[model samples]
Target: MGRARCWRHRSPRRWKQFHEGCVPCQAVGVASHDGYKRGDDTVMVDGGVGDSDESGLRSIDLATLSGVLRVCDVELLLLDGNGPRAAFASRVHEEALFCSISCGFHCRGRFMLPPDWAMLGYLHATDETLSWCHGVPLTPGMALTVMPEGISEFTLSPGTHMTLMLVPVARVQRKLTELSLRSTPPAGQALSLFNLASETTPLAQHYQQLHVQLGQGASLQPEETEKLLHEHVQALLGAGAADRPGCSRARRTHYLIAQRAENFMRLNLRRNIYMNEICDAAGVSERGLRYAFEDLFGTSPNRYLSMLRLCAACRSLSMADSSRRSVKAIALSCGLWDLSRFADNYRKVFGELPRDTLMRAPAQIGQPA
Candidate 1:
């Protein structure tokens, strides 16, 4: 479908030439937790999870990241094992002309994402693997996906960061038409240029530049933002899809085993759940356990378990009644002693110090005013 009508521009250069990211000479917004607005259609929020669920599962409020994202549409990426829980932080900038998005979280298990909007995305940095449809892995860096094409699944390593480069649907449609991508007129399918490396490519360089530009938080004209997205789309359309192999049944079996292991791990989040313990519970050999986790979740058993514990701790701190609880007390309950280590891990996963979450709470809840 077409987007809301906006000012038009002559068709820019095709994929060969490179263009720097957007340039915003005038100010349009400010950076704060409340969010910055450029116009009636654009709103950006800088926020994180509001509260924690019973299982210490903290749902990320994507609206805080971008006004355009619906909380119902964005799924909760599960942390399947007995470990820490995590929260996500989103910086959303949705405007009449284009959108710039960045979000990060730490989840130590396999999770599913719903087939939602059609947009081009890049895995700026991840220790995990993202797959769509029949396990067609999306390459890292600046690459485009029809997004909903395959069954989209992702296993985020501890503290994985993802950023998206956005263009208006109008320009996106025009670019798609040039490639003759067979997804029909209005709604197009995810497409890519094959054999493209995520690093050392023009796409990657362009993406990084945009990342910096957005980071600047400068006020911008709609055309300045629109051109960045338009040029990026041109580059994607210029490339062709590479050959990709399908996920095998054997790999699927390992995944099933990994899922089982995750369940066992989740149960032991409050205790030190050793690899050997996980192996016994999942009915797989030690080596098999390692392979399963690496294949399915993209991290070794220990790393994943650590992420679970850290996230769970973050929730406890966020929800702690200041009067009755202390950071050390909460950390201990999460089986995370060694206050120094706990503090370090907390900051790494959550992007804030543990004391910050504790201090941010309403004084009447866990602490006296």
Candidate 2:
């Protein structure tokens, strides 16, 4: 068995960002001595820069398959060779968005998205190849996005290096409102409620166009680009989250803990919350509090607090007379210090801009009959 060379990222900042954004982002510095084994399966491996001299990256060997359905941000930078392949699948447990740019790589993979989302995909490749499905063929350089009833499939070949990003839209909107002080505008203001697949509005189309144009240009700065893309992602998540109603189901233990945490946050979202403070209030150790929050909400204490503030902001947006009070003031009251981020998150989660949410009169909460 010949040893494969390892690949590790040399830049520290980039490495840090990659790890923070995609936990378990490991760089195999180089692939092991064994070259591509004919049979091996690993769903994910640590991320690294281009391959180094001494080691080759690990392959997703077909022998052992491990997958976990959880909310995450994943970025894969691969230098592919001949006869390489990776296959992924999920049902009801994931809402995944993938973007593949094949400078000179190829393979095939498929994906399934949660309902209420029209599948949106962007695939860029060197050779003119196509993915034909649902009675349509997506040509190279031409992006293929589908909103299948429930799921979709994908394929890649050797020399196919791509980036795939996935987000459960249904959960996105809820987290958006939870994270920022903004309300989703009424139906009239929203261009359209999310259906699986159809022509998008002019405004939505424009965003995609601009993004593509910028991606092709060399003048666009990576930092600025990442910031903008991150905002777009946040907005997408928000739109995804808004499809569901709030605080519906509740359990005894989970309810009490969530309610207590939420109430405590409501009282102090305007102020920065410390993890220890939350633990002290919940009568649990810091680790215990952190674990509970992640288990119940799929987020950390700080993240949950931010979401609470956003939730309060959403409630207030519909209740308070926004004509007189500005959204900035509302956000400040909700514990968010950054107006720009608040607005961005507001727009992302609610499917409409913040001003739109405030333009109309406040709404009254429905009373139980």
Candidate 2 residue-wise lDDT, 1-369, digit = tens: 011122221243432333234323121322323212111211123222233223232233111111112222111211122211232221111223222223222322223333433333333322323222221233333332233233232324333322233343443344435556343322322222221122263323433443343223212233332333344434344454333222223323433464456457657777887777776677778776666555444456776566556655755564466545788888888887888998887655444455665563223223110
Cα lDDT of candidate 1 equals 0.48
Runs in model 1 deviating more than 4 A are 1-34, 40-119, 123-162, 165-208, 219-257, 267-277, 280-283, 291-303, 319-356, 362-369
Q: What 10-residue stretch in candidate 1 is worst by lDDT?
A: 14-23
Q: So what's the TM-score on candidate 2?
A: 0.30
Choose the strongest candidate by lDDT: 1
lDDT of 1 by residue, 247-354 (tens): 577676676676577668767776777778899888989889888777665677887677656766665665567668998888877778688998886665555688
lDDT of 2: 0.38
Error of 1 at 203 (Å): 5.3
Candidate 2, 89: how far from true, in Å?
34
Give the per-residue Cα lDDT of candidate 2 at 180.
61
